[model samples]
Target: MMNIKVAPPYAEDKVLEIIDAFGHSGKTYWKKRNTIKVFEVGNDKWNVKSFQVPHLINRFAYKYVRKSKARRSFEHAEILLGKGILTPKPIGYVEYSQPIGLTNSFYISQNLSYDFDFGDVIDKEFPDRENILNQFTEFTYQLHENDIHHFDHSKGNTLMNKKSSGQYDFYLIDLNRMKFEEMTYEKRIDNFNRLSLTADMIEIVGKKYASLIGQDEAKVIDDIKKSCEKFKEFARRKGRWKKRIGL
Candidate 1:
């Protein structure tokens, strides 16, 4: 079975053209973890993410018990927009299934050309670094206030654009891994675990977030730092295990 769902405001014909060209080739944006291709159709740009095929158990689960990643991504984008959170406009999604299970899937969305991501700030010095970090912290606060737990709220998942109005606009990508539930204070702080690389960055975000939430800044910083360190250690251990198993 194959399914395609497009946003109502977009022209269906143009969307069909992009969908047709997705299986072929275009300008590649991401090809390492998953494959993302950019296509120019008419005057607009579209991004089609061809999700890597899942493992056998996951394939069956996605086919039977859960929605495909592409479908989840499309729906999550709509949810974010409804909540006044910025994400790329979802174009559509395509899912292909066979007798065994889901074979392949692709998520389509408008390409957001932004200044840079949080990763850039982590690695290099950006102008107005503290201000940007504060705004990002506020953004995360907003998400937590609304009970939107973005599981993969990592560095590169967020795109920042300095608007002409002299404010930073943020948009989140990679939307499939998310949870919508009331979050505890500890869970909220842990959400930042995957975001920063250094203690300074953690301190900046934790302080801003703590101020907004009226928590002790030092306590928030300490909690976030410990969570980040634990996550990093787990990642390192996982990497070693993967290597040992020849994964």
Candidate 2:
């Protein structure tokens, strides 16, 4: 928001053949955890996005996950899509192997134009903010209903695309830290609020979510609100208390 992004080197050469029709390419960001490169293509006109695969990151992520997880995260998108959740479609993914000294990956998806982070928009207003909020709510709900724990739910990872003539679309990025699982109501609800929205944003968005899904009069919504606080508090403590063993 405060600072606009710049393009990565070789952006022109890497311009996705399909997306070239949109316009020029520019602005690339290293998505958190080295999961992928989020590129801002084109200019002020109709800027698009190019997801350049998750190459490298060393942590609990890189060593532990097998190719199966990558497949799951991508296939997982289909589940969300089926539930009416809006996210960038995973067209394909590249891989790395021992035979090759170096490995790289690229995930191709059409950029959701008009998309920006909530942190970026806090200082500005986008039309259909309510719709954006509602869609976001459903997205979180879907993740929880299915027990997909997004290890990092920060506002930065949660992006909103506001179209001038239509409703906004919500996308969840940074899959490396996600904890996909089947869990109880409390854990699922708590997982949804672990890192993203602030207290107020969560309350407002959570309420909007309840309204969109059902009546908030029932305590389910209130329970979710409380769980959000609890989860965040736990994640905060867990992060601070970790020890660097055998590092």
Candidate 3:
């Protein structure tokens, strides 16, 4: 069985044809556990992400209990756009079902032409480093204020494009693992844990975030440091277990 949801101005039949021809057509943009490809339809470009098929338990769960990751990514993109957040324009999602459960799925969106991502900010020394960091901190603050918590808020997930006015516009990607609800102080601070920032970089972010929310800069910086430490320890334990199991 097959299911598809698509936005307007793009015919359903055409989108289905693209999905059917996905294997041999399009340019491979990224490939790993999941694959992303760029396809040209008429004059516009689209990015399609094909999710890996789930494991035994999750296949059942996705079929009977919960939505597939592709669906979540598409829907969450709409929600972000509705809330005035920047994400690529979602085109659609397609899912295929097997006798036992879901086989695989794909999420499609407009291709975003970005200059850089947060990873560049962390690793490079640029003339506008401080300015970019301040703008990024403000963007994250807006996300929190809007009660959006991005679980995978890491360095590579946010794309930044420099505007003609010398400021930057930030766009969030990887939309599936997100929570939309009221945010507490602790939850907000913990949200920064996934960012691979150094001590000095975190200090800059913490200070800027504190200024936005009227919190004490020193206390906020200390809490963010503690949160980062806890995340590091958790990662270490997970790594050890994976190594023991030879994963």
Candidate 4:
């Protein structure tokens, strides 16, 4: 596995502590994790989100040497941007080492103009569902083709920018658990199986997505199932990326 590290900007900034410590009841901490705190600063010149660090989902023994979960999340965010994937661009981050510095870091990115998780639309009754399924099928195929596991693939973690016309533009969020290195068959199955539990419901979601993207269903169902497992084979992952890149 490649030694993952947070890119520049974050690596350079001296992590700032829970801020607005100087402003009006300006100090607000997150209730969920209770680790992060936020505040509006300088007439909202920019918003800051701060919090304690978290651990990697699978790798904890390397607590000291390996990158923290925060770093992985930020790294995937940055990597997706580099790959020209549709997502928010980072502004900067706050990194610190406990005791001496803030070990857990804070990543700040440009707030996407308009975005919502897929979960928001589900169970809301979209007239055309087949299209959504097609879009989702094609998109998931694309992701697997690229050998990206997106370990935390979920409604909340997956986001979208809604057009003023009420159309969706997808984006993935909360991406620390991504599996990007040397994908294996079992690993890929693990990824989809986790999703298969919701496959039927997701299929309905995909149908709507396909309609939204203006695709056909004549061959979509078969295609989706194949694409679902195709990437599991190393040959598929490599060949797909190669074919797409014209290699």
The best candidate by TM-score is 3
Give me candidate 4's TM-score against the actual structure: 0.58
Global lDDT of model 4: 0.50
**For model 3, how does the per-residue alpha-carbon lDDT over 126-234 read when each residue is reduced to its tens digit?**
6588889889999999999999999999988999999976799999999999989888999999999988878988889999999999999999999999999999999
Report the C-alpha lDDT of model 4 over 62-176, residue by residue, as the tens digit: 3455665555667777777776566665545544454323334555544444544556545446443445444554565556556777876655555655465435566776665
CA lDDT of 234 in candidate 3? 99
What would the TM-scores of all predictions be?
A: 0.95, 0.57, 0.97, 0.58
lDDT of 2 by residue, 1-247 (tens): 0111112332433434424332244344443434333454354122233233334452224324544244344555555567565566554433333331223333444455545775563332555555666566677777777667776776677777665666656777555456657756566456555545555556667686556546563465577667776766886777777743422
Task: Tell me the tens digit of each residue's lDDT in model 1 across 1-247.
Answer: 8777889877766766776777686799889768999998778888899999989988898899899999999999999999999999998988888878898898989999999998988854678888888899999999999899999999999999998755899999999999899989999989998986587888788889899999999999999999999999999999999999999
Better of 2 and 4 by lDDT: 2
Clash totals for all candidate models: 0, 4, 0, 24
TM-score, candidate number 3: 0.97
Candidate 1's displacement at residue 206, Å, is: 1.4
lDDT against the true structure, each candidate: 0.89, 0.52, 0.92, 0.50
Query: Which has the better lDDT: candidate 3, or candidate 4?
Result: 3
Model 3 misplaced stretches (Cα beyond 4 Å) = none
Between prediction 1 and prediction 4, the one with superior TM-score is: 1
Error of 1 at 165 (Å): 5.4
